[model samples]
Target: MTGLAGIVAAETRLSMVDGENGRLIYQGYLAKDLALNYSFEEVAYLLLYGKLPSKTELHGFQCKLAENRHLPAYLIRILNELPEDMEVMSVLRTAISSLGRSEFGWKPNIDQAIRLIAITPVIVAYRYRQQHNLPIIKPSDNLNHTANYLYMLTGEVPKDVHIRALTVYMILTMEHGMNASTFAARVVTSTHSDLASAIVGAIGAMKGPLHGGAPTEVIQLLDEIGSLENAELYIRGKLERGELLMGFGHRVYKTTDPRAEALRSITSELIGEDAWLDLAYHVEKTAIQLLDEFKPGRRLYTNVEFYAAAVLKAVEMPAELFTPTFTVSRTVGWTAHVIEQADNNKIFRPQSEYVGEIPS
Candidate 1:
């Protein structure tokens, strides 16, 4: 009976997502502050090693991350052959599954982790180009994770703020305790599966509308509303039908999501001068007011999806690539968690209540 939902053990190393206070903290530091003040390399070091890296350690880590940025030709060919009409997430899933078939597929060593981190941006960039019939841009050794991803995707270096926003988004989405995708990863790792398989499983879970698919829907809702004047009508109509606003609530966060605000300010900074900034701000204000006036006691504040979509939209990344880009950044966390689970190896079976009658 005690094993029904097997304890994943007293929470080991991780930042707390403080729902009530609207804060996300890594080793006790706030996420919004981290995104503003730290580089992605620094944040990645903190997540993987449980402490901030020294200057030399960070440089070395960044080098290793950059080293794996080059994808094998075979992988790129496979990606190019995928149907252009396929959804980008589908393409990512297929590509990772393909990697699972490679020689180093199931290895859990440092090499495997580096490879996953390095090539994720490549898969994302190549698929994006293939979808658009544009030439694939290669990764550069000089650039860090955030910079390289932007370069490969757009064939140019991003503005400092844009890069910083993306780096924050990556860190924010990196790891959360037992999120659907993270849980899926644990289940796969329980089988001593390869990194690619574990990632594929996580991607499958994230494909669900309740999880990774919300950002795309959030963007769609904004476009449908078209202007600030219609924000109230749009959100009210959706809520009246008993529909949950796409980016407003979380299953775990009882009060607010801290990552939302972190990304919210980033969205504003990135959208500087685009008229859409004003439109989105008005929408945010209207959404808050309506949620307060209507839902009264509910603490449905913005989650990461709200500003994530806005920020990415401001960067001109297509709506379809939101989740795929999410996958790329989050792959680091998935790999880190899988390694952690395998190091303390345990099967992740959970039993459900037997509600049905016994068979004769």
Candidate 2:
């Protein structure tokens, strides 16, 4: 039972991670398809409500999300008071924890889920702008979820290309099968805890490097390689030295990550628009070839974090905001799991084996 590696903890109607086959499904739709064709709000609605929303329903949902995007004055004041030296993730965890008031208590519902999902990006943007001494941008009623997030961060209406790229990233990452953060959310919800409390726990788990830090590392790897010409040499040197290529493999996917494939397809269409993405496409090709030559039978391929780094960088997202952006997308999944866990509640109490023996 170490790390519960093979244990099936709980049943969920959310996204399915088919690592053996390199597919991800949300409710019933292919996550790749959803990312390629749907809006962030649409896919998020699907995860939270168990189906895609009709036009009217989507409009209402969009308005509800937009309406809730503003932070309370008290939360803003609290964000201002936090130390500048604190990690953004720590600030995010603390800001989210502060929302665990009476209204967010047991039996979490869609309204609460919507509120949490809508406000997470705002919280991150607020803290980010505050740290940089930039004026906080209010959420735009006209823009969709993904667009508004970029707008809030940059104080400009993002280009359609950037929005499309980031929307695909967000939709694809909105959920996966039970990972660390989702498990933490469910574990808290099993106690009939508030949604905010569960989300706070989830954010704490996501702050861990093993869980949410890959995209930043991938960015670093891309930066070091710097160009298509260096791709082969940089990657070959790393492999020759027995260093792990940050974005080329995944623990879950034995084959190519479907999310990565989908992102590659989208970024390919906009190839010359962003150099980082163009370089990523080249680098991935070179790395796969090098990986096969250097580590025979390893079956290493690009994971989602590979192109996630490219997309975020193309949109001018700072490296520090990488995991926090991931958090914003994953909040949809966390709240959905919280609601599901509340429906069929079970307090998690796994037994730990004791290896130490009494002195004889």
Candidate 3:
């Protein structure tokens, strides 16, 4: 059936994607409330461990993540050997495979999950630096996950605003029902596979443009529009010409994505009237108004990708690193799903309907 649309193939208590209501719930806390109140680490702990942590447990969890952030020398060498032209997602997947193989485990565990989540930023940082000829930076035990990732990328202590903003993004995106990558992860885990194999397969799924790669195209669209004056005509022209706007719609949310609403506040706080931010806001309004006029009854509201572009650009994140950065947060959800699947232990075996004429 059309990409398994409307089919409930599995069960979960991790996160809920309430598409009709345009709400995302991570373990009973509303996604927007989590973004506004909780740190990424707390939310990650909530997703995996099934509840928020105590102060001491939070400290211990932070220490575990900080302790694992440094990659082995050979992994760094792998980053160096990767060609500049190679897709970063492939390198990331293979590097994860290498990391997984180095550690021998057949079943899912918290340690495996922690290491995968912690080390992903390091992998992304080293490779991104190597490609740009920037100096590689080490992880700091002093910093939290978001700050540490920014420091590793920029080789400077990150600003508080950037860390806070990205922490919201991480929390909002950490888990959301059975997304493609999460499904891929659970499917692999159901076969009694290694943790790395499952994560590797998940990464391969996320690399597709229809899934994780949409935000970079949002960057391109915003750039092409360029100014507030250009927004209405530019958007209306694209609508009239039957071209799709990258950030205006989603397969899930029937109204404004809650994550988008959360990020709009972050973007406003960080951008503070920048020209591109202004233009993006205007484009959003004009696109919404025009979509109602042109295609009636289509919900077509602003989804997370729209404000994700704005928030990332406000933090000075390069367009190319967008999806890879997504991996850093999303790994938490994938690992949690793997553990859940391993606990339940069912091999996914869906039957395909045969339509071709059989030779009898």
Candidate topping lDDT: 2
Tens-digit lDDT track for model 2 on 36-122? 988899998898898899999999999999999999999989988999988789998998889889879778999999999999998
List lDDT for all candidates, in order: 0.77, 0.91, 0.86
When sorted by TM-score, best at the front, the candidate numbers are 2, 3, 1
Q: What C-alpha root-mean-square deviation, in Å, does candidate 1 show against the real structure?
A: 3.4
Better of 1 and 3 by lDDT: 3
* Candidate 1 segments whose C-alpha is farther than 4 A from its true place: 1-10, 101-107, 225-246, 268-271, 353-359
Tens-digit per-residue lDDT, 1-360, candidate 3 = 489888897888888888889889888889888887889999999988999999999999999999999888898787778778876788899899997674637888888999999999888888888888888788899999999999999999977877888888888888878889999999999888889999999999999987887487788898898888888889899999999988988877888899998877666665554556666777788888999999999888888988888768767898788999888889999999999899888899988999999999
Which candidate do you rate higher for lDDT, 1 or 2?
A: 2
- Compute the lDDT of residue 63 as modeled in candidate 3: 95
Better of 1 and 3 by TM-score: 3
TM-score winner = 2
Name the 10 consecutive residues with the lowest summed lDDT in model 1: 3-12
Cα TM-score of candidate 3 = 0.92
